[model samples]
Target: MNRFPLGVWLFALALAAVTALPYVAGALNAPSATLYSGAALVPSGAAVDYNSHLAKMWQGRRGEWDYQLLFTHEAHPGLPLVQGFYTLLGALSPFDLALTYHLARFVLTIGMVLALWVFASHFFETPSARWICLLLSTISAGWSWLLLFVPGATAQVGPIEFWLIDAYNLIGALFMPHFAAAVILQIAAFLTFEAWVRSAGAAWRGLLLLTALLAAMGIVQPYIILLSLPLLLILLGYYVISAKLLTWRRALWLLLPLAAHTALIVYQYVAINNDAVWRSFSEQNITASPDLLYYILGYLPFIIPILIGARTFVVDEADDRWWLPLLWVLLVAMLLYAPFPTQRRYLLGVQTPLAVLAAYGWTRAFLPRISAGRRPLLTGVYVTLTALAPALLIFANINAFAHPQMPATTAVYYSADELIGYEWLRGQANPDDLVLTTFGWDGQGSGGRMVAALGQRVFMGHWIETTRFEEKIAQIASFYNPVVPDEWRLMFLQNNGARYVWYDDSARVLGGWNPADAPFLEQVFSSGSVTIYRVRLNG
Candidate 1:
């Protein structure tokens, strides 16, 4: 129990509860007039992003083995392996989408907390240091939280302090399991490789574990390699040069898993690039890193201890364990600004290593210098300050749920009739059928994404997945406008090969044109204000 203590379990469960509570409460309290999406209320909350993931999960539920781009309408060669995580979940889930998603999320949340704790345990001798590291890594948001109060700061600064899920543990788990899974996989791979390095007789076991973890990563989010590979390489390089472990045969064994990871990633890249539709989606999916200052401020109190740990490591070269976390912190710091499109992905659980270093630094370096009585006081101050961002996150999420109609929440709802309309259309439309609806995902735009995610291919949805997002948005607006001639509308429908028109409450505000006025339209389904029209030949 000391190794995997009760405290970690308690801490993990508490965080998981915090993450799950608002969404559960929101669902229970939702009025019968509307169907709760079972997503947290939002400014970039669980629902918006998960809709895309839920789409993949929805496909899995339908027994579609291949990963199809459901957000955008196109016939492209789908992958059997890519993003198969959600697909796997969909296949395994007996519950509805929302329930399955939350259950998986809760489990993954607990797993992520435990994973971070285990990873930290390797570095810190005392449970106190490990626990402190866990707190810092999981929740320390720094001065970045202060930016939320600033009039224009969060937008200008990238909101890494509090909003970005990949930037922190609690938010990451709260957003989606894939985010936390990325971290989990990385820790598992690192530890497995580390074990392989130390164990002479059963080194083959490490290689096999590495292969499995990397393969799992391929399905979960291959972009995670943008962080994991460099750190592993650093470990390998240090071992080869400093420890003199570079007997060629042993080196080759270690190199094999690294090679496997690279080869799999390269193949995935080639496969994605081979598909025109998916390639376009990939090209549009850019997550460039924000300024370095954002990160420095975002990590706050942990940064000081991380630096102390680094200095101590540099000065002493005492513990090899210190080497890994210190190098991880430095490498990630540099990678955050690399010219790669997904540079910000390097932020994935970086705070974990930094927190490990911080705990090491404070206990080993800082504490001995201070008086014992004052040490607890200093630690108390540190914990309180570090707790700021996490406390704010909890408050913000709860507040959003309490006031569902707040500006931050947006149009995070679907009417009962709207869901029923989707159900009827899902039964009618084939897998490849194209759905045309207003371009908006939240607020004024039609819930085309909701339609798309529920298993139909929409004409356009999603910021990144949808090819030519702005152009399609304009074209969709024009298509919805009453002033547009039926000839143009007919041509637009035919040209895009859109099989169904989704006109819901939001779409109604865009234009009041009746489908009966159009010669090529046949009303196939209607529920209250929501209408589904099937395209037909004018003859």
Candidate 2:
């Protein structure tokens, strides 16, 4: 009994270490990337659309333009919501608004920790089990890093704050918009599972919450929410089978979340073609095929121990019959089947279960095997290591990943660089002048909110996602695929918005890959990676 309380304290220390250590390192390593030093910093890149839309939401409530920019600008919805809410909380100031955003993010991280505790406490009657659950929650690969470095996690940096990997959406939700969405989803799951397990009767509340959450997630980051649904179902199934005292009333609670989720799906179908977007999934994220083995290893580095523990940890003959086996089967299936040829981000579906498995593994290895005589020494060793792992694994990787000195990749630099240029353009461009760049993700018009931020019009860019973009996405694929046309070059510039073309070094690399004989555009100005071109639109 004494050990349980001690273990809880150890877990609390571990949680603090996991969450706080990385941010300290990031702050110490600050100025890693180039700070946008020029003129007005406008929303650019993929985030432009999300920023513009969210800003539009605040229109009329405040000045349509100023409030939109103030509330929704600066790369994420998370900040806006935080700022917006704080503004509402009092007569708002920028500092208060900023504090509210970070404070909310910190609180959400705590909520996640609390959820892990509840989840662990319920499942594991053994003190060891509780310890493992708490440990796993702090250390799980995606969950831990995601909570720490992501803007929603720290309420700073780029906007890609959603559950997905997109820079824009993540930034959009950092203000706790998506965090709120995710928490609502998990809470619904928690309540439904609670009712399901204890047979506590139907939870109409979980169902209602689930509907609102799914709807919000759909409107914000639809694909991520869609991907998460199957895994959530599997988890729900695990909950339904696990609770020892489940009643028919508890069984009815399952229907509530499901009904709510189903209604949202129906609403999405009527409002937008989900199947259409899903069908494009295979084509859009064509990276190296995800290996089942690699994903499993990523999630569970100590699979053998976990499996051994599951096999060894026997329930009493009177215990819940369906619980252990169902959890195991669901975990195994998710591990084996969750990975596909698509992006690794889709693997997020399996993370929650993997966290559970990791928790189980930690408990089995570290908790029950304690010998009374050596318990103090063993506990000291375990506590020391648990505290160190976050510093070692989480902080080290975040430092490497978020380092500004690292050369930007085609995918990574698009938004940041566009912000740089948009700041410059804000001073240079007149209201009558139009900023021209490549269609989609040419890294020029890709940041439309930046253009809008400058009060200048973008001739055309990726954010518009025009009818011509279907082929543009295909052309983007041509960098890796064989089917794309050479005409993509001129077509991209002329088709959408191009009064003056801006070409970065990346365009040159892509141009070399093109098979076409079209004449290159004339370069008027050259500055490092940023280039200006006046392309004859007709040619």
Best by lDDT: 1
Cα lDDT tens digits, model 2, 1-539, are 44336555555445544444433443344453442211111222323333333333323223332222221111211222212332332233233322333444455455555555555665678665565555544443322233354345334332111223221111222323344335434544544444434433454665565556555544433344335465455555544455334444454555655565556555544433333422232244343323343334334433544564665445424344234324533644543344443343333223344445555655555456767677556644554543343344444434543564554312322344555665555455443344443345543333344333443444333333222345545544453233455466567656544545555544455445432233646655555667555566566
- Candidate 2 — worst ten consecutive residues by lDDT sum? 70-79
Model 2 ranges with Cα > 4 A deviation: 1-105, 125-129, 140-184, 196-256, 266-282, 286-289, 299-302, 314-370, 373-421, 424-492, 503-539
What lDDT score belongs to each candidate, Candidate 1 first?
Answer: 0.75, 0.42
What lDDT score is found at residue 208 in candidate 1? Answer: 91
lDDT of model 1 at residue 480?
A: 69
- lDDT tens string, model 1, 1-539? 56689989998899888878778767765665766676665446355576778888888898888888777766788888888899999988999987888899899988989999899888777888787878877766567766667787777654565656677766777778887887788788888877777777546767898889977876687876666788788788878789865555676776677778887788889999998888898888888877666777777678787666556757865666666776777888778778787877777777777778778788878887899889888987888887776676667767776765654553566767777877786677786788786655442355434643476778776777677777887887777688888889899888888888887766666676776678898888887888888899552
Report the number of clashing residue pairs per model. 1, 24
